[model samples]
Target: MTKESDDNGNTPITGDEKTSVPADLLNIEKGDVVDISSDDALLMALGYKPELKREFSYLTVFGQSFGAMGIAPALAESLIFSLGSAGSVGLVWSYFLGCVALIPVALSLGELGSSMPTAGGLYYWVARLTPTRARALMCWLAGYMNVLGYISIFASTIYGATLILVAAIMIGSDGTWQTTKYINYGLYSATTILCFGMTCVPSGTLSKLNNTYIWFQLAMALAVIIALPAATPKEYINSASFVFKEFQNTGFWPNNGWAFMLSLLTPVWVVSGFESSATIAEEASNAARAVPFAMVSSLLIALVVGMGVVISIAFTMGSDVIAIVTSPLGQPMAQICLNSLGEKGAIAMLVFLWFTSICNCSMLLVAASRETFALARDGGLPFSSFFRVLTTNKTPARAVLFCALVTLAEGLLMLVNTIAINSIFNLAIMGLYFAYTMPLVSRLIFNEFKPGVWYLGPKLSYIFAVYSVVWMTFIFTLLLFPSYPNPDETQMNYAVAVLGFVLVFCLVYYYFPKYGGKTFFHGPVRTIDEVIATNLQLEEQLVRKMTEDRAASAT
Candidate 1:
């Protein structure tokens, strides 16, 4: 149909043309088809090439995801609430459980990521490991759920930042910063716009930016630990040691127990985003090595640094804990700051906390965009072709824009009511954890004995998978219950919201036929051989060029 010339002025077969180049000369199989397009030609057509740069090392990867401002500030609040109920001893136990639980889970994910370094991460793994008929459905559901989780994370960061900022401004100027409905809505819109703008940058530049944010988070965390303790009232430390005399009843929830249990969800919300690194496996240089490192390292760092901040604040504020927890600012840390450091020190702490929130929002935007792009590339979403388009810089610019718009809409929706914000936030947590655990559960249930270089040994791996599933399920169930209200008026409406979102997913799956939704799970899972074959093709081309260079030098 068409013809072209190679560099040596020889006729090049083009447009599905089959040339009889000698099998030995090309060393290609009989049925193998090699398309010869110059780099410039491909670049012109595709707009970008797959980046093979290995600029990021393991440590950088870990820092970018773990050091994100989003996870720490949220978790800090959760830790405070949990410690208030269980005391320091109970709080210590939870951290221990988290560490133990995460080890095996991290190991299993590490093996999977290393063996199959695709950008789609767990969903791709699921697609390969599960039954053919269910791959598309599972992937689509997982994508939707994960998106919700990330959106929640984004919103929470913005909300937290706004709270701290408003609190500091009010305290500094002798103005009362009450947490009212309208103020919260205004904060949500402003933070969302700021976060969206940060994400519009080219993806290549994002990693370096994230790295800087990580350092800032670390510095702020250190500052809080040092400054809060030094400025606190000495009597506050004595009061912290006094156990609760009685479980007080707040009209919102039945008793302090339920209140505390629901409150534990706050901490879980913060410590997440470890999986954010996994979503970028395709862009990562040597992803297998980097993804695992980042995931595990971030978790460990979050654990240590988060604990340090929580314990430091707890000991410093002591008796003021109750007041801080019930404060209108909705920031437990700010209360601690006010109690220990007085007004001036409190303002400083709030500034740092807000700064961390901004950093967290920026990182979340990047991770969410990557997940969106990865799903689209696998034909798991509507209008997959548009999402697959990349900019000249090789970033999924379309997907980034799409995620930004969705975030903006979600933020705007907050103006409707506090219930709307709470509903979305709760649903986000459930959806994210659901997406996170499902692929692991699917692997455990179906392909427990699948062979691979990354195998974690049959018995231990399955046990870890089972444990992860159980833990995640428990957390998801608890999340459904209202954290701040009694059973009668509990946010049962939020559960309805979750169901509505699910229905939307189903409708998209069943009705959208133009995007190959019908064929999502129609075929068998792609084998490791197929993956290797694609990789080898690229390798062979490199080898061929090297050989040609040698021959030219000799001549």
Candidate 2:
């Protein structure tokens, strides 16, 4: 038996000493023992001291997830893909099918978040669930992929916002002005910096901002759904049959079914970031309950509201879907609005889209920075100590700054051409899904998963996990195919190359000779002693109270 004082100057029993439980604690029934009563305690139990402020309520956490998903705005950005593939019918049905497919994925992630809520999110879950021998490798892949996905999402959000802003300008200018690549890059850089600034605000203000953004998102979607149809010229409004049954294939796919499957990319990307709430689990009040509920509920809301928004657009969108796809305005949504709502209304809606896009960028940076900090704290990165430091206000300021820099750098790729920049959006979906797969695969293969407070039943949990893995694999494969077959250098999908590079980097970084991360990385470093000490203090308080109550009764 051995005992040692921990960093907090509390003596924690180690090895065989753990068997001799405290006398006071021994009298307490197992069920009566309070393991966690607050977010701080729960965090400590999960091997991390509470560092971030727990200011986000259930609503704010939901806002965080929903804002990151940016459903309506994201759909506007990716509408071209669906319109080109299966036409109006594809846009409506593909979103429904994709959202349905991803619900199981969200449920599986919610269960893991409840069981071991942490900022590391996917990577941390992988580490805790995988076999000892494979823990470091699995965690490394998940961590890098998760980080890359968030960075790519942030980059794409800013880029998408820049496009919306430019589209608005062109509409406002009556199509007299044209945007150059440099102009787009300049706008992307500015938006990235703005989002970074937003992310660096104090935690309390950030929570309020997130709450505000949620209502803002809802209002924007409702406005477009209600107004776009009302404003459409009578001649432009499509019949119900056209809106629901129209099918066309403008892309050069060998089969129309294959093209329809590829259109699932839009909803796959839009319904994502539900797991984002899990990334800030430690920073949310009642994290065990709030995290999972926020994830599932936010996704549900995004799906229903997002579908309404898309359906409204389809009803009002002009008959020439191909013309909308090949619009000179550079955005399919912009073209749709222009045809239905005239110049001023189009500009107004595009401005709303631009604002929502910026909010999405800011919201996503919060999750991205937290994930970066979590990985760095575990010695998973090169400058772990530096990246892990928190601001005086407890924000992961350094991580925010790092992500912002990466977002800015990624914008440089646009210099090559818009097609090259498209890879960022593709990588955003593929990389996140790749990270999501690791923990689910680990749970199924090891059979070591313990149900958390928010889990489905044992059988349902396995079912969801299996379904999520298979669906993600299917979507991932579809994303690798280009929009057009026999594509030249400019039209090719380079997401496969980019994702391959990241995977190879992860492999080499962990397995390379003497300096490999495997030598230093053990699963999540346990700070169990902190929680042990806290539990001991709570037990002592309970014992003291019980003794006093007994004496008073005797008197």
Candidate 3:
């Protein structure tokens, strides 16, 4: 290979076959520079040069909102209440089953994350590992499902926070807690806005904020485990075992076992957001390892801590648990805290609960935006280009803003009626389960036999995958039914609202092709190498442009 300096004092390297510089040093000739090598072109394409960092602490990996005590206790109480009598046992069973099912899913995700760690997480994995024909649709659906999950999370957090606040006032004062329509709506709106505003902070700053939340959760967990138990009357502890063999209204023994099984879905919803850690893979240091560990660890902690607290509270309260859960006051956990700990202890618990809600909201915000960005990156949604743009800070600013707006809109819907709020909640849960089922089904039907970098050893993976699908499908069906016996028109209307949304989604999907529109899914798997190549090509282009400008200026 040989290269010579041009008249402008720039050297161009060439193969052994040829090339020379002009003799005149003052004169320069400019021409287009063409690189024949694909590798070289690819290196020129990728814009940013990200240096992988090792800044993540182990605590940071596992210490997120999913494990928070405030959220978990509220969630447990909600499930217990929704399940009623016979439903309580079923709810507990479902929770355990869900946790067990997560083991294989986590193992699979860990392997995938380890191999190709990206911020998009599962959708990114789908794009890289699935056939191209299916990539767009899979990505789009994943994005939708991810957003749904986050929205539900946001709503739940606000609901939990509001309950905590209400609990504080009621427990502190001698008067009954007032529950006016305007007051409830105002609380939801305020919390939603607060959470949305908090998300607008820079990513690095947000990370630090989340770390603070992790500590808050720890403290709250300790307070619940220690303070609440110590303050309760010994007599109150003995009252927990008085079982109601029949419902006063329904006269049904154990209050319908099937209904109880259905009620378990509420708890599943509460403990469900652990996957948010994986969704922020792009932002995390060493995400491949960190995301998976964070996800699985969060779940384990939620299980251990959540069940422990619930059981402790249950054993202490005895028969009062049912009365507390069924009360019109409507916030069982807060009621329990107040009943057991009095005013000061209740306030402490409320503060912790509030903090946990904020933490969970933060995680949801991040997860939702990432899903929107990931879908846009794959050209699977409208205004894809805008959504795909990353700010100088390397965060998806537009997507974040868009998600915030949607959250605000949903929050506003709460003012319409309780039915509307319930409807939205049910729809969100349905969307989440629908999303979860798709990937599991896709894996089972299409990629079951395909070996890749991450395999759960063929037989077991397939078996578990099958089990997951069945479990999800069963739960999905049951979730459509209302919990209360002989539900009022409002409850029926809520069910209709949820179903209506699904029908709309299906109809839209059906009509997309009628106008000669392209379907999101196309064929072929995209490897990690492909994404790297695309990024590198952009980088090389920038470098080449810089080099050419220098040469021209010298001339």
Q: Which candidate leads the pack in lDDT?
A: 2
The top-ranked prediction according to TM-score is 2
lDDT of 3: 0.56
What's the lDDT for candidate 1? 0.61
Task: List model 3 lDDT by residue over 1-555, tens digit each.
Answer: 112346875453323212222212102234433332222221112221231122344455555435432345446335443445343343345456556666665555555555555555566655555565665666655656656666665665566566666666666665566766578667767777776677666666767777877766666666666775688877666432232222222212334656556555555666666666665655565454576677677777777766655555554443444676665555666666667777687677776676666776666776777777766665555576787777765667777777776766666655666546655555555666676666566666566333323456767767776776677677667667665556666555364464456456634763477431144433222323444454544334334444443454346
> Candidate 2 — worst ten consecutive residues by lDDT sum?
12-21
Runs in model 3 lying further than 4 Å from the true structure: 1-58, 64-94, 128-130, 239-255, 423-425, 448-455, 485-488, 493-496, 499-503, 506-510, 513-555
lDDT of 2 by residue, 293-341 (tens): 9889988888899899999998888788889988998899999888888
> Residue-wise lDDT of candidate 1 within 70-168, one digit each (tens)?
544655444444544444433444554555566666666766665555556666666656676576677666766776677666765666667677778
For model 1, which pairs clash? 231-340, 232-340
lDDT of 2 at 103: 81
Separate clash counts for every candidate: 2, 0, 35
lDDT of each: 0.61, 0.83, 0.56
Off by over 4 Å in 1: 1-54, 69-71, 76-100, 176-180, 243-260, 448-455, 484-496, 511-516, 519-555
